[model samples]
Target: MKPNASSVSVVRSVTRSAIRDVTRHLRGVGLRAAPLALALTFAASGGLRSAHAQSAQTAPAGQPSKAARDEAATRFKKGIDLFKETDYAAALVEFRRAYELAPTWQVLYNIGQVQFQLQDYAGALPTLERYLSEGGRQVPAARRTEVEADIQTLKGRIAFLDVTVNVADADIAVDDTTVGTSPLSKPVTVNAGRRRVAVSREGYTPQSRVVEVASGDTVKASFDLVERGANAASTAGSSGDTGSGDSSVPQTGTGSTSGGSGDSGSNVPWIGWGVTGGLAAGAVVFGVLALGASSDLQDLRGTRGVAASDLQDASSKATTMSVVCDALTGAALIAGGISLYFTLRTPPSDSAASAPRTRPSQATRAPRATWSSASRPQSSGPELQIGISPRGAQVIGSF
Candidate 1:
């Protein structure tokens, strides 16, 4: 309800008296100009809203009033004073209050500056961006350039996180702030240093990790969630731990054992290459042996004194060696090609296929069986089969 003109005058008189009291208190507090400044701020803010409205019956309500602007200015001044005193926390509160009342681009600039001083770089970045974009014409080009440069510096001290959960639609969060439900389309940019990551899905044990990242780095974390059970975990990848797995089994390769799969694992490719080299060496040895044998056979055939039966025997031995050499060479080529393929190809990720295998229940386990030496397949020690009949003893190959 609108106040009567007589009531407005009385309120104005009270406001004027209060301003005087505040001014005297400020002067006594040793800030000489504070009282006068505050009085001017209050008076310029149109004294009291109700009192002003009584005098200006035609004033519009939609537009911002002179009183609000004055109050915002007062808050801005107080924030500056607190900032000079190095009380950044108090300054931040005052700056925020000013911004709330005014919401001008200049007020946003002050808020961003205060947040930066408080070491809340993440909060400051967006605020500064808003200042540059919305207050471009109001601010000088040099000021905008400085803020953009500051933003770049801030980003340098920031990092990002990209999380992958084995279970689809699992809820995910970073630093206690919800990014969204997985799988996230992009990584979340955050301040540098240690950060907490969490993922949750109904019917499955939740997974979390604390990751430390340097400035400008992007870290990817995957969660191979386990179902809820007595053996299931309540947490994973805890501080100083390398992974988020329930099993304590030692990691055998560089590839992840969680929600993602690796290409043949880190060791497999190297092992394959080693095998390839070994096979190639074997092939070379065999080829050299075959060539030596062929030369010997040629020499034997060229000799005029050699017996025909002797020559035939040497020729047969040379032919067998040559065939073996060819086989070994072919084997080397095949193995090397496979190794090369593995080294070059990017392995497709298979979250399920890479999961740990559970042991069979005692009741469902296969029964143990034993076989006699003569009946069992020849796959034991030495990889060679040897037997002696009544006729004689002879050496034999495993094949």
Candidate 2:
């Protein structure tokens, strides 16, 4: 009368499914039972150890195959060892696997302990509560009270974020660290303080919010991400995913150019080149004036019976013009040097340098639009609050 292999497999599948449903129901509010709570749950249904005994008494030996039970026990042992080693993450995985096979409260307890050890208090709270609820008589009344008290104390230090997200499978991040996907099982627990929450998904704009929560308070942060204005025309031309197809990208180059030095450089730096050209022109003009005044002086001195006053006047004029010419020449040289330096030092904005280059794709692709992200609190209760954006620099520019 022993149950066959097929029957045992069927029982395990059914039990796993039932347990999963129960787990999901318990977690509908966003938490789960403690790892050890499985012991009580299993015991209430004729404790996990009593499972085979009940099966044997009802029918025959090996009702639930010994090998299967032994494997579950082995997994549980490994989980315990991992927990002792302070490898809480590994322990949780092992305990979960054991629960899948046997679905014991003890495994749940272990999982909860690991979560707590890992400082995932928000995740741990629900599981521990579940353990207590189902622990029933298996947990001593005094012990249950102690655990419940602990749960209450833990709640005081934690704040809850009940997030509402529109996009399915969108990742949610708390304080820049990815927490989980959207449609959370329950409110995410975090330390009381200012927290940043964000949600993102493909083909949709990312949404984020900042909120301040006092200890024991619950806040709402909801995300309704918008779909991108996907355009194939834009994607084909974009160097990166963010490129606007209609916009012409600046080509990068090296060295600088000045007026009349045409390599298709737009926006002539008149402030630099104009000064250089003007100073050079002034020097030439002054030199010509000085030479003419000196020539007049020579003519006045060479003329027979030339007046001393006329000669003296021409000499003084020549001297004055020469000094002015020399001063201008020096000024021109200095001005020219400064202009050359500035013209050669083209700012990066004007220079097309060895910037990262992107190629236009021939294949049709979706073009992104000017995307703006906003969030609000989606709540049915009075505690529901709107999304609070963190203080940030405002970027304003023309397209």
Candidate 3:
């Protein structure tokens, strides 16, 4: 009545298949009964000639591979040893390895503690911030206090910038070296003294000013650059009025001249007046453009489900236009003020002397038109076409 070897083999195969199906079903149900099912099946099979029992005995259920477990244990041991020896730096390396193997808040806390002990307050600030930001109720109050104090101390020594440049994209130079672009909002530190500040942008005259910085105090200074036309006027006035006979003839040297006084007076009057009128026009254009950009930005903010590409394009164009208009407008105003000041102080020429000069007026008007054109809002089609390319967006002249 004993079964033959082939018959017994067939029965064992059927049992193994049934066990696999049940294991899969349990797993689908989120149950952890595969190991127990395999154990019972093997025990019923006389604890021999069963592959599942042999595998289970060799590698226990739910346990990681031997190599991984060994590596983790080694890292944990090294971390504990370093912590005992008070070698925080070495400990941090080992602890970090353990954290990578298995992430836990305890490991992060240890890292933060070591960073604090090493006086790397800047590095510790972010880690502590992350811990706080996680919103875990387990973070201790004392640890929070320590991290906060460290951050506050670092902030005191850190130099920040609250830069306000009249021109956007204008390079802000501190002590003759460029630091950042204008319209920066933070406090930046320089050697506490009368530091030379310069703001420079293409198509506009460079403006320089002196800022006296005190220790632990933020210095505020802004560049009020003169537009090209206004700058030309100021240069002409300052250089052309020298008492020397050739001064009114725009001498190449730095000497004063008085001989061409009549000619200089005649040329200066209209050029100055044209520069003033152009600048005022530019101001009006800039104001209009600013209001339009603000309205567009507000509209974009309220809109939903707009294509990402369109939103990005609108935002970038609005920002660029806003900056360019404001900068140009500011430069024009500065130039206008300087021109007005000089016009009032200088003596007027007689009508007979003024009648001959007419070319300077025409020359000054071209730059004014260029400035006004730059301040005007761009046509949508051409501007969008240009904005698609890198060079187009960087066109500072037409910005």
Candidate 4:
């Protein structure tokens, strides 16, 4: 049933009395200069009716209907009651709901008041700024000055973060609260202290960084996220050189066995033998060259017409080749002994039986996305490397 003129007048009168009482209570609590007072003052003086009437006439196509506006008014009154009861948190929630139901600028003022009362300076700063921007000339000059001063105070207690991300549509969060998605339109204001900012996307590895900022400072943070598949591919490529030739092969123990048997791994017996064989071949080639040089020297010495310089040259060549051949022969013997030792070493029977078997498919596989650095097992046992040049043969390894 539609309310009669007398009931409407009584309701308005009761609302004005409640506003006056709340204003008095705020003064007693040292919140005399609060935006709450300004909000209640305007609301008591028919400001809400004027704004609502104006909004209804020029309401946009998607604007809330009359029922939504009525609901918003109910929620706004509930918020004021909660605020009077000192339940600022509950008040903030109701005010926020009212703003969502009917996006009038006045609710923003109430929201900022509740936020400030709750000591949510970071949240209040933006809310009040938005109130002023939306309210425009509708907001009285005195009230604007008061809200502006409150904003300055809020700025003194909070900080700003200009977060940037390489990918679009990535979610950005500050201290676990989702602020916006990448390409964030503006800087995110937060309480002054250590804050953890995280960025995540569907196809990329999530990234997070902790940063500290003082109040009123503006800090810039950048994130370059890597695609999940690409990161895994890069890791696999880097570990490829260090990976075992056949993942199916069972690894042997590298420690010494107690019973005259070697627990030490063979250290790739075939490779050691191959290097020894190559050194031996090199020795034979140098020996042949030395022999040829010596034969040339003999021929030059036997011929009377041979130049002395030629004989000297032949002798020098033979000496150099002989030295190289001897060096190569020595290297071959050392390499052969090392290869024999490696081949003779056998893992303990217990170790061989206890060795874990890994399938080829399981060896190179990794998580598509991860927050930690990639890790790979190191190959055990002494590594033997051998190199041969025209100068001589060189062997590097631990016995």
Best by lDDT: 4
Q: Over the stretch 236-265, how does candidate 3's per-residue lDDT look in tens digits?
A: 887766544453554232223234554565
lDDT of each residue in 1-399, candidate 2, tens digit only: 344666566656644654565455445434343333354344233333355445454524534354556567667657645554556688788777776766655455666666766767766787778777766678777667767876887687788898889878999999888878988998888878888998999988888878898988989988888877655445654656445432444433322322223432332335556775787788788899999998988888889998888888899988988888877766665555444443443233332336543343511132221223342223221221112125312222221
Give each model's clash number. 1, 24, 16, 0
lDDT of each: 0.66, 0.62, 0.55, 0.75
TM-scores across all candidates? 0.39, 0.44, 0.26, 0.55
Where is model 1 more than 4 Å wrong at Cα? Answer: 1-78, 97-101, 166-172, 177-185, 200-205, 224-399
Q: TM-score for model 2?
A: 0.44
Q: What are the per-residue Cα lDDT tens digits for candidate 1 across 1-399?
A: 466678667756755665565456445544333323333334334444443564454335664455565577678667756755667799789878866765566667667766776777877888889988887686677777778888998887778888889879999988888878988898877788999999998888888889998878899988998888633333342532644353455443323432333433455679888887888888888888888988999999888999999899888888888888777766666566555544544333454335444452532342222336674544342222333456533433332
Show where candidate 3 strays beyond 4 Å.
Answer: 1-143, 159-162, 173-181, 185-198, 205-216, 237-399
**Lowest lDDT 10-mer window, candidate 4?**
368-377
CA lDDT, candidate 4, residue 368: 22
**Which of the two, 3 or 4, has more TM-score?**
4
Model 3 residue 58 CA deviation in Å? 34
Ranking by lDDT: 4, 1, 2, 3
Error of 4 at 35 (Å): 3.7
